[model samples]
Target: MQFFVWAAWLITIANYWFGTKQWDGADFGVIFSTMGISSLFMPTITGIIADKWINAEKLYAILHILYAATMFYLPQVDNPHTFFWVILVAMCFYMPTIALSNSISYTTLKNGNFDVVKNFPPIRVWGTVGFIAAMWITNLTGSKASANQFYIAGVSALFLGIYSFTLPACKPQNLISEKKTFAQKLGLESFKLFADYKMALFFIFSMFLGAALQLTNAYGDVFLDEFKLFPVFAESFVIKYSTIILSISQISETLFILAIPFFLKRFGIKWVIAIAMFAWVLRFGLFAFGDPSANLWMIITSCIVYGMAFDFFNISGSLFVETSTTPKIRSSAQGLFMMMTNGFGAVFGSLISGWMISKYFTTYYTNIGSLSKYVNSEADNAHLLNFLKNKGITVLQNGDLSRALDVKDWHNIWLAFTIYVLVIAIVFVVIFKHKHTRAEVEAINHL
Candidate 1:
């Protein structure tokens, strides 16, 4: 249910921006930033409440219920300003539960005397499966661009919110004995982890990669649906069902997450993360060259690679923090990890990428009906290109300007993303160092 809450909207948000709202690219940044803004404090604040005042499962339930209610109202919002605040409220309810869910799972596992390191991965894999299932449901049902997608998400969330209360209780540790300040009780002391050279470097890299994560979510659907502008490709499967096509990525995520234990055990964290970083480059590069018609294979392959690209870093990085940090500060360390990646990193990526798209990828066409007037003269074509390029615009040469306006700028936009991945990969290669072993896993479990 938690996974689906995110999947239902994440991929299709771009479609909503470009298709339903007909909003500018810069506005999409505001949409994506809600996630980051919510992430900035929601997880930590909720963590404190769960630790001190509320039961984890109960808090989780309340969050979901609130989230569902907000989602139900989202389709009614027409103005972007109203939409932003509504989405922000929804995110506030939604984001904290991610960490809360992890906490609930870990507590449940420990109380049951199950080995978390051995048992948790298998259960967690189901969350990814749930995510994929949600994506498929939304895509197959053709709710990708409809307000009904929120209805689907809201109904499911309401069920999960209620169901969470039925789960096993996760009580507070009460470790301090005497009451400490709220910050101290919540494990804010974990901030000291930043003082460690290796830990700091790992976190910095996580931030960089987090930046890459939002790119596809912000643009993938818009890119696929943009093909509808071309008459020949308008009827293509991808154009008609872009969300379902993109669901392939979530499906791939499930498979790769199941493989994480083997890969982490065999290659260690460094190599696994390197593979993820490089895979991101391929993911974007493929999108740069792929089309619904001739390059459908590239598009599909890119989706397949998304599994490895995302799980390799996110799951592995979380485990890395779990294993490396002290027990007293473990939860706080996880929150900090999230803060860096999902908060600062995501905010920067979404806002900047949105600006880039609005500035460089949006195209304008003049004298559209008189093709010969513009195309036959080389000087005229160059003049047009220069004019568009100077305005950070894309010029579609496919003889149909109106339909191609939204996507023509994608070529240049994706190139810039490709460059970002390359630099990030290089930095990861230089800075991050970690080795996973059975012995180390055993040690963490003991702790």
Candidate 2:
């Protein structure tokens, strides 16, 4: 249920921004920035509360319920400014639950004497399943961009929120049993992990890779719907139900997550992460060339690669931290990992992508008059072709008038992402030296 709330709208918001609200592309940057800003502080603040004052599970439940309530009110707002505030409020409640959920799971596993390394992955896979199911529900009900989708998310969140309260109680360990400084109480001491040269480099690159995480979420659906500009592809399943199509990535995530332990054991973290980085290269490059009709395979393959691209780095990185970091500051280290990837990483990714889209991917074609000015270069022509192909719109390849394609423009965007991934992969290969071993895994579990 937690995963579903995010999956339902994350990918489709760009469609809402560009298509339904007719908002400026730059404004969408500010919209996505809300998640980053919220992430910067909310999780740590909530973590402090869970650690010092309240039961983690109860806090998790309350946040989810609050998130659900805010989501219920989201569809009522029409203005972009109002939507931003509402979504920000929703994120404040929603983001912390991610950390809280992990704490709850880890605590529960430890209490049961079960190996979290061995058991938690299977349980977490269900969350991805939940996410995929919600996407399908939204798509089948024709509510991907409708207010109804919020209600779908809200209702599910409410259930999960309440259900969370019933889970095994997770109490504070009170690691700081004696009087301590403010920084120590807040887990700020974990920042010392940065002093280790290898750990510092790993975190630095994590932030860089984290930036790529939100790119597809911010624009994938918008990219698909942009296809409607072309007459030939607009009515096709990919354009019309792009959110559902993109759900394939989450579906792939569930399967790939199960394979992580094997891959980690066989290849080591460096190779695993390098493969994940290359997967991102394929992901964005595929989008550069794929269309709804002829290149549908490219799109699907990109979605498949997302599993490896995302899970390899995120889950495996977390495990790496788990096995390496001291138990006294393990939770704090995990939060730091998240801060790098989801907080700083998301902020940079959203801001940069928004700028690139507004400045570059958006182009005016002189030949089509008013229509050309509004179309997106990436998917607009494809959409135009889709409309012509499916709806029989007349398209003329003219002699006197020529269509100016944004060839150099989009090439730069893909090139930027490719370079970013390549650099991250190379750095990971050169730095990071920790190896996972049975004894190390056992020590981590004992913690």
lDDT of 1 by residue, 1-447 (tens): 789887887788777766766666777887888899999878877877887788999999999999999999999988888888999999999998988898899999999999997898788778877887887888888888778789988999999999998999997765557767767765677779989988999888888889898898888887888765544565788987888888889889878876877777667777888889999999999999899988999999999999999989987788788778878788789888888889888988889998888877776444344434334566656655553343344545754443333434677677789889989898888766666666557643442
Clashes of each: 0, 19
Q: Highest lDDT among the candidates is held by which one?
A: 1
Provide the lDDT at 180 for model 1: 70
Question: Superposing all C-alpha atoms, what RMSD in Å does each candidate have to the true structure?
Answer: 5.8, 5.3
Number of clashes in model 2?
Answer: 19
| Model 2's TM-score against the true structure | 0.85
TM-score of 1: 0.85
Q: Model 1 lDDT vs. the true structure?
A: 0.81
